[model samples]
Target: MNYNGLFTHKLDALKEQGSYRHFLEVNKSAQHFPNFYYTNEEGVKRSAINWCSNDYLCMSTHEDVIAKLSFVSHRSGTGSSGTRNISGTTIYHRELENTLSNWHKKEAALLFNGAYQANTTTLKTLGKHIDNLVFISDECNHASIIEGIKSSGNEKRIFKHNDLIHLEEILQGINIDQPKIIVFESVYSMMGTIAPIKKIVALAKKYNALTYVDEVHAVGLYGNSGAGIVEQEHLEQEIDIVNGTLSKAIGVFGGYIAASNILIDFIRSFGTGFIFTTSLPPAVCAAATKSIQLIQRDDSLRKKFHENVLLLRKRMEENALPFSVNDSHITRIHIGNATQCKQLADDLLKIQGVYLQPINFPTVPIGNECLRIIVTSRHEPKHINHLVFSLKKLIYGDDTHNREIFSALSVADVENEA
Candidate 1:
């Protein structure tokens, strides 16, 4: 058995299946967000409007977040220096944890390097520690949750995405005396569909199972204070643990779990992923704290982001371009074939200056390939119009301009009325 041959075979299989990932190099400017510079295959620098960035609220480059980051970096130097137990815990970390706990209305919060770390560690730890822990997970949950559940060697059952009946059936089948946990996500990122948090919480209560809700995508875009869908539905208290990321909506690079003090302390003490890993930098924690503070104080950013989503949806509808329909801000255009998905993304970048990275298999199921479009607060009406027009022409071969689509609408006009 040749190790080199085995590795080559896997690479060949991926390439042949059109599932190989090629990351695009993009540099976004603080001055002109939503517009970025990317190098083409020929090494030519091209400008494009970003359509797939996870910087949902455009807070990554916000002045307030930048100021906090710069100040924290200056004061603390660079890295956290070691793992949390060693010399990593700082005033900023404690402050950020406090901010998170307050936001989620939880008893305490624990920081991890990222959402993947938090979810994986928390789930595995709970499964390992609890007696006869049974995991009931949503079928469409992100890889992080599934991996965490699997790694724990727990008895797991997967319910259909957002299918409460299926979930209830599984819950009913489990013994009432057995310890169990329900794992799901607030927002299914790839398809842009939201989970039914209230009903799920109710079921968890009836079955006496712990509930873990991953709100990575919803944290900065939903609810009164951008706490997440749980907050929006007034179910924050129902969830036993809430896992969130600072990378996506918060525009920083970290993740955290909000829960009761004992649960958090238990994870901190027992979870290998938490204990072995270096903590996130002080600057990242500070920036995330500032981002949360600013977002909580002002609902304007979330409103503006939704307005952009509406504008994009309206344009796509007017153009008759096929895309996934959901109330969430995500816009997913179907491209069933993987090769076609890749080609479509390349064509959009090279021809129309629209940069949306193609999402393919393992991230999403094969034959369900699609282009995920994330419209941010920084995207104007013109950008939305142009993106719709370009997508129509490239995908549907509808190049004819429909003046009615633009319709003299601007984000500023919408904001002014608000």
Candidate 2:
């Protein structure tokens, strides 16, 4: 078999369709971020401003967080050196889990290696253990959720994104006594849209279904204590399960699911992903615990984060850029075509030192390609202004030149609340 030829053919197809992913090697500078050093495809180290970082509050570089991480790593060894059941459960892990459960106002919490694993393993365990379990998920759910539900070999129903009416119709078809879970996200990162969580919760109650909300993008960035959207919207007691990531907004590394003690125990005991995989290192748990404490005590970081978000949206609006608004800390500058989206990103990185990755299929549907920007608290007005100015020059061309890198965008193709 010409195995290499087959692999190359498939990879070439990805490049042809512009769906191939090329990772940029970057080193973020604590003193000057948004501005970072990145090694390009040509192996040249270049400076660039990042507008797509998931470090919402920049807590990863916090002095106290770093101190705790270093302290733990020095006291303990570097690695856990075992799975959770085999000498991997340290005091740091227990402390972090306890802190998380209290923060989410849940009876218990179970730690996972990553948020993706948390979702996939938790859902898989629930589906496999519960007889006749059904998952009614949002169509726009992350790939991890889709993979888990599909892997369970259970019946899966997908409703249109945030469409309560369609969701209810699907629920009505299922038996009232049937065990079902409504899986969705608190914030759609790519489009900067907030879900109708309250309405979805109501539907779940009416249908006697469990609710699972992925708070990966919302935790440490919402609520008074940085609990997440449930706490922010006063739905903490209503949500059955909340899966969150320490890596994103928390600015650490790990994932957890907050739930009732019974459900938590069940997953921890039976989940293959949790039972067999190695646990998080002591330093990571310590750093995450410290970061969570910081977020709870400080609101200035979150305020600055929202301020930067508003500044960015305002700048884009002033320049008549085609972008969508969901009153969140994300800006989705719509370019429509995948090829054009990649071109815009490349031009911005190469010519203006601005960096943002393009969102394309199958991450998003065709014709919905765009550049998703996530501004952190560290980003200032100058960075926002630079980004807008660079985007305008590349997308709209300067007065001296007639360079048109993108086609004319139609009102229908663009989704703007400007």
Candidate 3:
């Protein structure tokens, strides 16, 4: 058979599994809120209320951030021109790193082009230093962490999601003398559930292992000054390394790892991802620095963010939508089957103007297809009502076919109030 035919066959398989992804072209610019305009394949333009973006605090289109971008572009130019070890180490980059380190209360911080590169490079570099390194990771960690651990070519073990007993059992079973790293995210993106971070950090200490916490989804959105989950829980000093991203809540592009000065220096000396790639643009660095300062000073934003999350959760509960348990603003509406989930998402977009992307395998497990509705700070009560009304119509319709699942609303209510 021709190779072209085989490639087509693979594409067909993806279609059959409801896993094929197509990019939607945005005709208009993104707003400060969770809505944007897009042009469809039919060349028709439409406004869509987006519930799939990770812009939790809706800072991406803030006037201040945009103005800072403009100011930085005019002053320092665009690209960093080289790697950080080379010509990329501009004054803007240094200032941004310093700001981040101060925010997280870490001794130092180093920047990366993106969070994926940051996690992968940091894990790989740190893993190489220890002999017989054992990595204990959550089974539901993001793809970046999974790839990083696998690339390290070290012995690894995975525990059930948020199962502290399982994790401790594995830790106890492993040889205590060998170096280990307990890797996990502060917030599990897909499930919207927060890890038992303080407990995990304690376990790491008991095992004499280093802790690596990924705060990509939590940073610049949690704590008093948006320092992330560690700060929210007041466990900043307990975590060994904290990985974060500027592209999310900071509304800019780039990633960074905050740790002891020695660890940051170690990664700088050996991490191939940092040593090889061009540094973030000078404008991007400046934008991030400004955004960080804004987040630190803006307590009202965090309060509004939490209020929006509570409002959305309450509405979803009232509508009797099936959802996972979560403490954060991220909410996953479980649609069960893959095809139905995709159809539901498409219906929400085309019929109701809601643009929630269907998350299917392998982002989730084979049977755990869901519509991950990310509620941002900018979403108002009217938006929450609109989502609830549309979802209720689609899920319940005239008949009560989903009564069993609808009964789960009480659980969501309790969880939300908790």
Cα-lDDT of candidate 2: 0.89
Summarize candidate 3's per-residue lDDT along 114-184 as a digit string, tens digits. Answer: 99999999998877777789999999899999998989889999999889999999999988898999999
**In model 1, what is the error at residue 103, expressed in angstroms?**
0.3
The count of backbone overlaps in candidate 1 is 0
lDDT of 2 by residue, 1-418 (tens): 9999999999999899888888877898977877899887788899999888899999988999999999999999788988999999999999999999999999999999999999999999999999999999999899989988998899999999888889999999999999999999998887777888999999999999999999989998888887878899999899999999999988999999999999999999999999998899999999999999999998999989988888888888888776775756778877667777787788889989999999898998887888898899998888889999998888777641314534466333466422
Candidate 1 Cα deviation (angstroms), residue 306 = 0.6
Q: Tell me how far the alpha carbon of residue 299 in candidate 3 is from the true structure, in angstroms, after superposition.
A: 1.2
Clashes by residue pair, model 3: none
1-418 per-residue lDDT for model 1 (tens digits): 8999999999999999889999888887978989999888898889999998899898899999999999989999879988999999999999999999999999999999999999999999999999799999999999999999999999999999899999999999999989999999999898788999899989999999999999999998999999999999998788999999999889989999999999999999999999998888999999999999999999999999998898888888787675677768778776666877888888888889999998999899887777899999999999998998888777656552322232343433322321
Which residue runs of candidate 2 sit more than 4 Å off their true CA positions? Answer: 41-43, 398-407, 410-413, 416-418
Candidate 1 Cα errors over 4 Å, as ranges: 398-418
TM-score of each prediction: 0.94, 0.96, 0.94
Q: How many clashing residue pairs appear in each of the predictions shown?
A: 0, 0, 0
**Regions more than 4 Å wrong, model 3:** 28-32, 399-418
Query: lDDT of each prediction vs. the true structure?
Result: 0.89, 0.89, 0.85
TM-score (C-alpha) between model 2 and the true structure = 0.96
